[model samples]
Target: MDFFAYLTRFYLPFAFFVMGESMQGISIKPGILVLVGNKQLEIIDSVSASKIRARDLTTGEVLLISPGEIEFELKKAAPMSNPNSGQTERTSLIESANEADIELASDRYDVLLPIAGKRPISKKDMIQCTEALKLSASQVYRLLDKLDTNIGPLSLLPQRRGRVKGVKLIEASAEDTIQEIIDQHYDGPGITYQEIFEKVKEQCLAKSIPVPSEATVSNRLRERNPRALMAKKYGSKAASQEFEVRGGKVLPEEPLELIQIDHAEVDCIIVDSEHRQPLIRPWVTLAIDVYTRVILGLYLSLSHPSTMSVALCISHAILPKERWLKLIGMPDGEYPFYGVPKRVHVDNAKEFKSKNLEDSCRKYDIKLTWRPKGVPHNGAHIERYVGTLMTRVHMLPGTTMSSTKNRRHYKSEQHAAMSFSELREWLIREVEIYHKTTHSELKCSPLHKWESHFKSKNGRFSYPSIVDDQKRLLIDFMPFKKRTIGRDGVKLHTIDYYSPTLKRFNIGSRCIARYDPEAINKIWVLPEGEQNYIEIGYADLRLPNATLSEFKRAGAKLRADSKRRVPAAEVFKLIRKNDALVNSAVACTKEMRRMRERKKTRLTDSGHPLNEKNAQQVKMSTSPSPDYSVKPRPYDIEE
Candidate 1:
């Protein structure tokens, strides 16, 4: 029998977080009302660490049970109905409140803000709250407890002192219970609403509560947010593509007004940097200006698309690219496209929705908007450009040619000659070519269109939106975490950071810590209520700088080997071991590829028994390479 077969025998209780730092998730204390299966219960007392004494809201019977027996729910507040109108008592309080009530609530909110979520408020803090609000210690505790009912300033609003005559109370409805079950079960897998309704009936029967009608359940399911439902059933990307409106292209007024960023897997196999062995196709994250159709910035990596990829792409798009172009060994090449876009449009991908990306965009006053949930045409600008780029990619050696049908009889891996760095350099040169080529829609080169917009007219030119503090711009783009500054500074990913500047801030104050994923040996900490961040390095500065990728891979290996709580030192040791192993493999692979290439070259030179025509074809395909050399000149000069 399945575990759920016995689920009906016992009721699911509301889960609670124990009063300690060791426990995680939302906290539940005494006096709070929670649902056990379908029945409402008030948390009356903590009888033991695992068991709690709760009173049944209906029967007023006090019973002791483990907190684990309950399920956590987002909607737990019991509705209190008015006698005349059947609406919750405090539902409209925030909106319908008088000016006097709003002002009073605001004052109370300020006084309690510091200690609102802090459990077991310190004696010193309790005295201060009493002094500031002119309320007793018990009153302060009661007010804080009220926050558990509903987490808002409305929870602190003035209410009637006593229950009014003919007033009615309502518990969590049977319809709501059915809806919760539907939300949980009717997604991802093929679970029907009928089956969900049956399960609800079983649970309700066990808990001795009235079951909701199937029609009620159906109505609830229909009322779910369509986008949210589709996202759960399929995926965020699919939901966006299906529901987004395919309106006509809305062009930006000028350059850098609207930029679109998206990732695509290059349709060609590439080789490794050291071994030149055929590696998996790399992914390129590209950002393009909508108005001019100019490539703003791009990041190429072997890793899949992630928050780091988007962050790097945005940073590249904002900063001047002269140094980057030179670093890729294209010193003479020109790529002038760089500026902070007024708005950036992206698909409904998880990386784009990350808090770090949102915060960084907010700081720069850049609008980060998601393309609508349904239509592919909504993101046509980026998609069309990617399609055009991939068409050119098919012309290169070792090209996969978009699909398997087009790649028939061709062994891409065998002909794969370009290394990752070589591919990157080729991509940069290709971008330059793309900018010079006449666009089908514009009837002129993208470079020309871009130049005309920023060119001096009436002794004035539209300068790009450049940031003054370039260093801070990059730092803001990095992934960040929130942690409290403790006695030993702050700990993130099991690593300690410390600095003298941290001493000025109060101990146990929560601060935002942003770190460079490339080298996380140091971090920048933004203390609470402060505008700028202070640099903090590892407590043990001797520790080697480790990339975020290495840390994740090492941590994963440890977890797979059943080491749940491996120390930071052990993980670093594993990272070093992994590096050495890769280096050793690189040497062996290089020698093997060298021997194979020599045999192929000899065959071509001697005209072996293999078909002469086929041999010639292979030679032609493999012999010719692009001329990467470009004469140094100003970007304004035409080819």
Candidate 2:
């Protein structure tokens, strides 16, 4: 975009990052909670992303995005500012207490927080308990007023005590005192809850089941809790504003169009069985339906970020192009393939903003959305998704192997590589699993909603909702590059390339280059008119061969009088020309002899081999012994 254009688009939108309301203390690495509505149609991402003003990456039933996606999800949920948007306990559910329910809520909180959490109490239960009990929302306060269950910082159930070792109990309950001792000691003896209860109650008999009345007490006391729990008292809640973003302002929620696509590189290394040490970077492509916070499609590859990979990813995965898109990750799908998104959101990755991709998107009426510069967190939705990638796509079968995607090696140590097929299988499996598994961060399993969504939509996935035709999908864009043939006729980065026509035509000019990195060195170059690819660069192309005959001939003729050095060049030249190389060869040989004679001074009268030189310098070669028995032969023989 030009100055004004940039101002109208990226720069203007980015200006929000500086807004007090925009950069509201959000962090690049913000805590996120992806929660699913009860209806399962509405997906919400509650971000602590106080930095940028944006929402979840996907919301449309399903989506396939890039690898290295990090998404936080609430295993449990609660309400946010919007009643439509509520928070849930990612770990457990907590509900506020009603008026009468305040005491109950407090009781529940006291009982649950130590183990489960507040929301474990149902919402209807909260409303009814509060209404019936006439407890205000000040549940904790009300709880403290009534429960005889008092301990510092914590009000336990009047029922029993948590036996924390080295911890003293005030207003001790008989059960608690014994339980504390039991908790501290018990490895040697298995003390069932029943046994503990019986002993504490000063009762006897072995079949240690809790008395039905005290079952709740025993159950609450025995349950193990995570170190943290939801607050019994309500924290400040977010307002329920149905803000629709438009013209740098919040408006009514409607016209959910733009979709975001980006690539997230995981900290994991790309490896397979073949190349143990992966040097190239493999990335995953992800597309999110902004309005729905759904992952539409994902593609993982051991290739660089290129138009081809992006195009192929979208082509193979994302289905039903009825949805109108402003920009897609790629430009345009090849003919016969349909379905195009309205807009594609991506970073300034070269592959994303590439001209080819741009042209394709333009051809298909897709709009490209670029995030603000230097504000990566601006795309926090996608960034969050990237965090979950592990090198080992799945846990190694019955082994203690560290995840390849996850780092187990010393960060400083190099890793081995994996074969292309192995890598491919791993990637495919990861994508498959991702589509199937409930997103660890997406409050609910996206796939579950996906099938239902596809079914309810009548299999229509297009904008305005049209029936999807997956078979019609086409290539939107493909990565391309130009390379020159070296004089050696070998392509760089290519170990093997060949085209009988190229060698026959013997013409080397600019040509399109394509190669499968997994295949390594095996490349194909397409000439302007050629329909097929020509592989170049092989073992034969790289090796150098002249001749050794000349050296052998020279050694056969011991030159006694000559003045040139080792005469390697002259010897080679004579061998090729078949000229009177004798004189030249003799000169070279004689020179070598003279140099050897000069360098050697340690000689015995009998001219025995000397060891005065460093032991490493001497070399012995196998040869026939001089025929002294018949007649001594000259050390340098003339053939």
lDDT per residue as tens, model 1, 90-137 = 345534566566566556766886776466689999999999989999
Best by the TM-score measure: 1
Clash total of candidate 2: 116
What TM-score, computed on C-alpha atoms, does each candidate reach?
Answer: 0.52, 0.32
Clashes of each: 12, 116
User: Best lDDT goes to which candidate?
Assistant: 1
Off by over 4 Å in 1: 1-248, 458-462, 499-506, 559-564, 585-639
Per-residue C-alpha lDDT of model 2 across residues 4-76, encoded as one tens digit per residue: 3311321111100001111222223333333223211123333333322223333334422221232323323
